[model samples]
Target: MLPRGPRAFSQAAATALRPPSGSAPERLCVAELPGSELAYFAEGGGGGDGGRPPRGFLPPPGRCFSFCVPSGPSAGERVRAARLHRRAEQRLSREPFGPGGAAEVLPLLAYAGPSGSRPEKGFLVRDRRRLPETERALEDLVRLILPPPARLLSVYEAAAAEDGGGGPLWRSLWRLQGAPESKVLLGRARVAGAAEPALHPAAPHLLDGAAVFASFEAARASLRECLSVIPEAKAVLDLVDGCPVHAKKGDFPVIVIEGLDATGKTTVTHALKDSLNAVLLRSPPPCVSQWRKVFDDEPTLIRRAFYALTNYIVASEIAEQSTKSPVIVDRFWHSTAAYAIATEISGKIQHLPPVHHPVYRWPGDLLKPDLVLLLTVSPEERIRRLQGRGIEKTREEAELEANNIFRQKVEESYLRMENPACQPVDASPSREEVLKTVHHLIKKQCHFP
Candidate 1:
């Protein structure tokens, strides 16, 4: 244990454990109100059926949310948990075939044994419609939060504090173990149980809610507070000094080109830089490049935080460079949010938040590009381009090639962003054609001469 938490920011994160919202059941373990002492296990349904638990209810330790509260929770924990539960229920209720449907739900488990302090795990309830692929993704989530040989117990009708109160109702339990090398595939993981509890709100954020970070200031404060274990704290701080307090606007046109790797992003960005006499930039700006791989090795939240922070650094640069000439970026928030949101949602575009949803909107704080050009290439061509690289592919790139659904989800996410939305261009044509198309879009969208 990292000797963490009596409050929100601990050496690591010490979990604030509590019982469910409801009272204990017959022959069940129970504790008094605020149930911080212990969580009770019962053998009865909320209905007075007196039906025993589907199986024996093992009195496992109550699942504590370190993010919700540091150690022992204050009133803040209940409020936060309630807020999250509301969001989750709303999202789930809107979800296709969610509640009332015969859709089978699988419980997700997360566990960390006093290792690094915080328990980095996510819990979710996934439907069984997609079968094998979804099944594999669920397995990946399990391996992500709790790797193999760390079996999870499937408990049912487990009471929740909300059920006791009027929180979103759900009844399920699962055991989990942490795996450092684990890379959860974002969406649904198949735990072998039929009890589909409501999804955790942060499920979409997935562990650290890195995708939720839109403002640099918020991200930095959180990073400093929660990420004491980061390898180069002083270096990170010094680097932060160079970034603008907030994303600033400049006089010149700012165009961001976004696409998967080998989708001619670099080529198009370079061309735009030359053609428009613009400054070319890439995210995780070279200034913060030193920290990319470090955070990449950590969990999803930390890794995403690094990228999120890097965007701020780039924003500062953009503020400066745009004053000199038009700025063309190889990738920007489009890439970050698109990939993050795409990874968060399961199945297809339909499952994603609707166009008007806040999740699809641009961060109010970040600098917006004058125009964002999204390059699209056919799957076959993209694969061919990847082969030509003769370079090692990133995990995401490999996933792009292997999972078409993932690719579509990413593209859809890009299209859904508001407040300076990304415009699509077909990169399937010849390089000259692609360049011409981009130039045309810039002139039309940004009035670039």
Candidate 2:
């Protein structure tokens, strides 16, 4: 028997003392009292049995008392039992234990623990009020934990602070994580704090909308920088692996002349190709050249797809040759866009797909030409030129000829293109005069003597 409350004998002792098997034991018995409480007694000990009655039976002590409450908790027992369980939980929640049921308490421990003492110890704390202390701890921990290559803790800290308001200590820690060096840190910080979320911008010089385009440009610049860091031959080989355009081993200054028919492109390209010692390669090139036939026989979506596919093949060939020789292309990607846009203007098509659509690709990734000369001629002049060429009209050609309106729209679209690579030349003058101006521009623009 034991005193009640904290000193009470545990239920294990009582269970051990009970006989293992019995109907009720004849000498010693345990029973429930009135309100479902337990009582224990020795029955025949007073009988003075000279023989030992039961080997395991010990004489009951005087004034034996109850140990635990008799009844197990009933369904109706709510408040009292719940209060006890909650108290136990609260006590356990304050300590640090290994992962499992105890791991959940770590965040709370972090919040409640002492401030700024053990820097590593304080980092787990997430409370806003405790952030100052936590930040200081993180900085110290970073120095201890991070190797040189991985030490961007300061940079992270600075970036976080710029993005949203936090404690000064927290911001300092972020800078340690986010930006270790000044130049790299500042650039990242600005990018992180920019109005728009972009990795790169189209034009770094144009601050007004630069942020809008930065995401793409930043990624491109990063890739380029990474490539530059590698050995040149290795980088080129890697580029070839990723882009089919680099498969050929040739060094040529490839000039691709692109425009609608009767834009004086053929005349200018022949002259330019001769002057530059370039090969005049035309799209729908001899090999895999079905698009030209499609254009002549069946002008439909299928034809468009064929034309776009052949152009890519030709572009790839040009890119390969560009390694060694100067290659001139009569028409390239610009013609693709012009024709697609023209189809749309005629109300024959709506919503042209993006440049990378399987049917067509934007030539943006193609090898950049040293120069692109765009011949600009008025609708009337173009019409006259077409008539003078004495070429049989296709359906598209007839449509453009019948409605000067369509021709004007196509011309306007071409002029409005935003690529910096193209230089427009007026084709109203005689072919010879126009070619001379073009030759002069090329000499100046491309540094040709």
After superposing candidate 1 on the true structure, give the runs of residues whose Cα lies further than 4 Å from its correct spot.
Answer: 1-210, 447-449
Per-model C-alpha lDDT, please? 0.52, 0.39
Give the Cα-based TM-score of candidate 2 against the true structure.
0.40
Candidate 1 residue-wise lDDT, 62-94, digit = tens = 111111111112222222332333333333343
Going through the candidates in order, what is the number of backbone clashes in each? 11, 40
As a TM-score, model 1 comes out at 0.60
Q: Lowest summed-lDDT stretch of 10 residues in model 1?
A: 63-72
Clashes of 2: 40
Best by TM-score: 1
Best by lDDT: 1
True-vs-predicted CA distance for residue 245, candidate 2, Å = 4.6
The runs of at least 3 residues in candidate 2 whose Cα sits more than 4 Å from the true structure, single-residue gaps closed, are 1-251, 288-291, 295-300, 345-361, 447-449
